[model samples]
Target: MTSLDDLPIRDDLRGLTPYGAPQLDVPVRLNVNENAYRVPEAVALDIVQQLARALPDANRYPDREFDALRAAFAGYLGHGLQSAQIWAGNGSNEVLQHVLQAFGGPGRSLLSFTPTYSMYPLLAQGVGMRWVPVPRADDFTLTPQAVREAIAEHDPDVVFLCSPNNPTGTAIDLETIEAAAEAARGIVLVDEAYAEFAHDRSRTALTLLERHPRLLVSRTMSKAFAFAGIRVGYLAADPAVIDALRLVRLPYHLSALTQAAAVAALRHSDAMLSRVDELRTQRDRIVDELTALGYRPYPSDANFVLVGGIDDPRATFEALLERGILVRDVGLPHTLRITAGTAAETTALLSAMAALRAE
Candidate 1:
């Protein structure tokens, strides 16, 4: 009966826990910021058909280069991108892991603003890279001047900017990204996993790529595409950067079925994404509803809202869980982050909130 303490694991990981969000089986699940809508019927049918076609080739290895998926991704991005400028993996987390593997190491460091995607530091630590998280403003906003100061002081090997960031749902403008890239002497990665839910599509950091070779923009099919189960995430960057990632990624990593399924979904992206507007409506409704309920809901460009007002967030989370509506208690004091689930789910959450307040 050997325990973990007896086995010789890496000292850094000896006491650490794995990354996870609660996967509860409640009637209303607004915890992980997953798109509530199922994949469009047409797209699902196409995926089934395409995977059926690719199933025979599963006996052989998938496209080691994933060339077709890259071409489709280029078309999807449509800012004069090519397959040479793209790289992908099971999810954006894996893509970022590649970045860290290629550039981050024991002596090097990764810099990002605080209260960001909690995974950033974990990714760095997994590879023995130092994670330096600077604090954001009280409103959860990053300023260009602050970015310059951090870069000037830390001189990290990589900088991460999570736009429409997780937990807080705060979005950083391109100016801040530009400043960070210009000030830093290393790669600047923008995590745009929630970009499609933004009110203004033009706010994306993709537009600045032509001038900033150091910039990398990561996106995923999980959110607006309603394809979280399929696990397709990609990055747009300089051809040299993509080439470097090729050195780190495992051979034929993406399965043939995943590639086929992603291609099918991308071909019907318009139909697949038709629910975004409705989700945005629901997200805003949550923001307004929380405000009216005397909670402080941060303005969100993403699908979830981070609201603060609970007398005890942990207790409120337990109360909501008992009511069959599960939301995220992100360790922020008096705050809980919730996905903008379907209308019925939203109603359940609001009803629970009102009931708890009255109590």
Candidate 2:
């Protein structure tokens, strides 16, 4: 019999490694950009209470339309419910997959900037779409001219921009997004996964909905809202674009329990806001300390900082691991991306760094 592994895979997916976050038993878990905190006890109890109220209906399938949860999400964002401008998926990552399904396929292409959220290319490959990347400037900023040129040259079906980008943690400006939207013949997706931690007000891209029918802005509750494990993400776009997403998404994509949890989380927005403030403060403290140690840390508006040019980043990573402190060593040589942990965890990292440097 022929071996299953001998069967031909999609050419685009032939050599791809499965994507995942690191798993290490460490005291300071700073590798993934998790909220670095837990849901408050009060919020946890309220979620339990809400779910208890729905226990009898637990046997029933979740709402296929997910209307109530969608409305709550839009209301939390201060957008109108009747506008048909929003969507939700298991995670923003899934939302990305749906976007690819809607606009990209075997013969089409997906475009994105490099050193961005790594998932973009993977998602494109999974859909059997061609993936194209344009490199950012050394400082990780996108130029309108370069973007316009790429749009004109490649004419891709989809483009993804991760603002306050992953790995680098630097944000692209509104002008860049708008210019990309104008120049592109296809969809322009702005992944604002870290927008809440940034200083700039969210551009929403909803504001440009009327002008750019193909624009979509994706957001996640995983980071600032401390809901990573619960898995909720949303998109804001023109009604037409959202309709396209709705067509491709799985029915009841948002579970009843998840909907309840997200609603409760949104209801306590004030408390979540407070946590964001605290995390931002901690992130700044980490940046200051790392810079004082002579490491070049990128100016970040997100919950993590990307510091590069360390000597032997792998050795540094290993040393930190030995001390029960975990941080991410991105593929770049001598560079590490550190997520902000609690004050105590941050102190542990600093201590580990000091010990490593002294050696």
Model 2: residue 110 alpha-carbon error in angstroms: 0.6
TM-score of each: 0.98, 0.95
lDDT of each: 0.91, 0.84
Candidate of highest TM-score: 1
What are the runs in model 2 whose C-alpha is more than 4 Å off?
1-11, 79-83, 202-206
lDDT of 2 by residue, 1-359 (tens): 87546778765556557888789777789999999889999988898888887667988998887777778878877744343788888889998899999989889999998888888888988888998998888888888888898889989989998988999988887788899999998899999888888866555554666677788889899998999998998888888888888778887777888888888888888898788888888889888888888778898988999987689988888888888988998787678999988889888888778667677
* Candidate 2: C-alpha lDDT: 0.84
lDDT of candidate 1 over 62-88, digit per residue (tens): 999999999999999988988899999
Query: What is the lDDT, from 0 to 100, of the residue 303 in candidate 1?
Result: 95
After superposition, which runs of candidate 1 have C-alpha atoms over 4 Å from their true positions? none
What is the clash count of model 1? 0
